[model samples]
Target: MAKKMGIVALLLFGVYVLCMYWYIFHSGDGKIPSALQGTAADPVMFMSGKELFLSGEYSKIRNFLFFIATPFEWLIYFLILLMGVSRYFEKITTSQTKWKLLQNAGYLFLLSVFVYIVLFPLNYYRYYLSKSYGISTQTFTSWMKDGVLDFWVSFGMSLIIVTVIYWLMKKSEKRWWLYTWLLTIPFTIFVMFIQPVVIDPLYNDFYPLKNKELETKILSLATQANIPAEHVYEVNMAEKTNALNAYVTGIGSNSRIVLWDTTLNRLTDNEILFIMAHEMGHYVEKHIYFGIAGYLLLTLLGLWLTNKAMRPMIARYGQVLKINKISNIRSYPLFLLLTSILLFASDPVSNYISRYQETRADQYAITLMEDREAAVTAFQKLTISGLSEVNPPLLVKWFRYTHPPMLERIYKVADHEGQKQEIPLKEEQKK
Candidate 1:
């Protein structure tokens, strides 16, 4: 049964890859609306003809990579269990230590290393693609350094979380899922609280925005939004990538308004202000809190489902998979495999909710800034810098888009400006 399931998983992955390749590469780029095109002096053009082609190709390849990576991750976990690699690691760890904590750590370290090695090729290809497309500026050595740092950080966190989860399972097999879910609420918050101050500094240097004039303007905007930001922070991302970005991160006192140096160097002051306003809108609307709440709810559902599904699967295929029970450390791969499948299944629903929140943030920014021209042009520049598809395929949009498509965003802002202009013209006619 294990062999059959693994084969089926491989076949399904192959079929999906082939279909996605044809769908993404064979399909033509989305056309720009004729009316939306303005001249160089009053430009609304998001991309030139050459840029449109390049962005389309780049976007398609990126979407292909993203769509494949999730299923591939599931397959990796499934194979680890099906092939008894998890059991092998379990045995080695058990032989090495009598303490359960030490054993668990040893097993997880081996698993993490194995998975990293297997996935490194694909990860490197992603970096290579970005470099070839003139997106990534980092050298291979620098990229590898960051990747290693990421792996260690992730492994450390997972070790802690997994140890607690297994401890809960040992305490109460039936109620472990509920207890874990409850624990995750505080754990998730703690991670978010510390992430900005602790984890982020590992990758790049962050400091107060050096342009005091621009920083003052941003702080003023933050004040208007009622965000208690003491300073606008900038990260040195120009050394790594050419992409322009800004975001609001963390909660309460840890919350930070961060801009990539790439963005500051590339965009005008008004454009930067519009982007800052958009990020501020996220806080003003309390989207972060809402996001956290939504995540917890989904996690609760996922954990419950995983518990329900895992028991039956173990009863049927425990012998074949070499996992005797849920509490057994050998079952770790099965647990992760089930959770990953659930997460993959929930991607569309989660992405939809995310897009809605993002749209609301955009609307808030537009209303707060009241500068439609800046908003539209800023989005255009962002699309160019990122080589983003202005209008992606429906499947890609549904599965991957956390924000609205660039074309949709620009059009909305342009239409809002038109309506505002028409209101005054109608008042004059009535007078």
Candidate 2:
């Protein structure tokens, strides 16, 4: 009886997934605008490139598209939310499960409230969004404490970085992006050095990785890479949730690779090493420098264009939007809400830059690393650990996901290694 029920459940899940895939990818009416199409040689990209080259007016051109594209982007987000809610309710079964589901909904609701309480004080870019996603674990009291810490740190750091960047812009108004890029190299190095000690601890507890054998193995890998093994630290990630993540952040005395406790517990030594090697590839490939340079150029251009275009709009609706000026970050949500509606209508171009950067990192990992098998295993583990669907719709993958879907990544690794491996059996299969 149980076996039959499990099979039925699996079949239902697969059917539901297929329906979503068709809805997102194959549905008609072109819900997305042509400007936001993002396919190769998409109209937005072609026009934007032409404008940038012909008129030397990148700032004006990008913002014009951004304004037009925002509404379409919001629709995409609404679709994502609908998918999430649909999936959440899809697994309902008996009355017992229904009771548990109610409890779970209440838990999530309370969590969201607590998160908002904590973040309302700091109330910056991420706070409200975190609550909206119900991912915030901070309590109301904890929010204020965390907000105080965030304000002090962010305030101080922003002053230094913003002042330096502004000074460079004023000094070299015409060549500001190049000068800012030069300044960013050292700024990045400093942030990398200080982040482990200064930034992360303000949010979560960090301790030394406790496993002797695992520590020894990873340290040896670091030695071969000419990086110091002493900075490898374990974060108490389980204290929050069950997500698995690992990353190398910051540089030199302050530089460290953090292995979330969940990642350490879930992945094998070789898989961990592969993940580290992927991060090292970012450094060795100088992606950090390139990313910062691109961002600085984009920001300089965005700021100039935003001022030119948004000033008139903000003046028109400044009172209605409750934003005093185009530059006010406090009115960020409304401004972003307005901007996003425009940008979304032109999705293809906005997402093209992101997709390019992500794929570049994936390519870097394969080209730079030696442990192809381990890389494949790491991706598989990450995919399963995150509960991500092995396959998502192509359009969804192209526009929404930051990293390629887990299965796509795993397949890429397998292709590079030139071998087929047995896929892992699902939970019901083992039963």
Q: List, residue by residue over 1-431, the lDDT tens digit for candidate 1.
A: 77788888899999999988888788664555565444211222435666666887888889999988988888898899889999999999999989988998999999999999999999999999999888899999999999999989988998888999899999999999999999999999998999999999999999999999999999999899887889999999999998999998898799999999999999999999999999988898888999999999999999999999998999998988888999998898888888998888898898999888888888888898898778777887888888888778888888888898886787777654443232222232333
Q: Identify the leading candidate in terms of lDDT.
A: 1
lDDT of each: 0.86, 0.52
Q: Which ranges of candidate 1 are over 4 A from the true structure?
A: 27-44, 416-431
Q: Candidate 2 lDDT (Cα, whole model)?
A: 0.52
Ten contiguous residues minimizing lDDT sum, candidate 1: 420-429
lDDT of 2 by residue, 20-51 (tens): 54554355422333432332112222223333
| Cα-based TM-score, every candidate | 0.93, 0.55
Q: Give each prediction's root-mean-square deviation over alpha carbons.
A: 5.4, 18.2
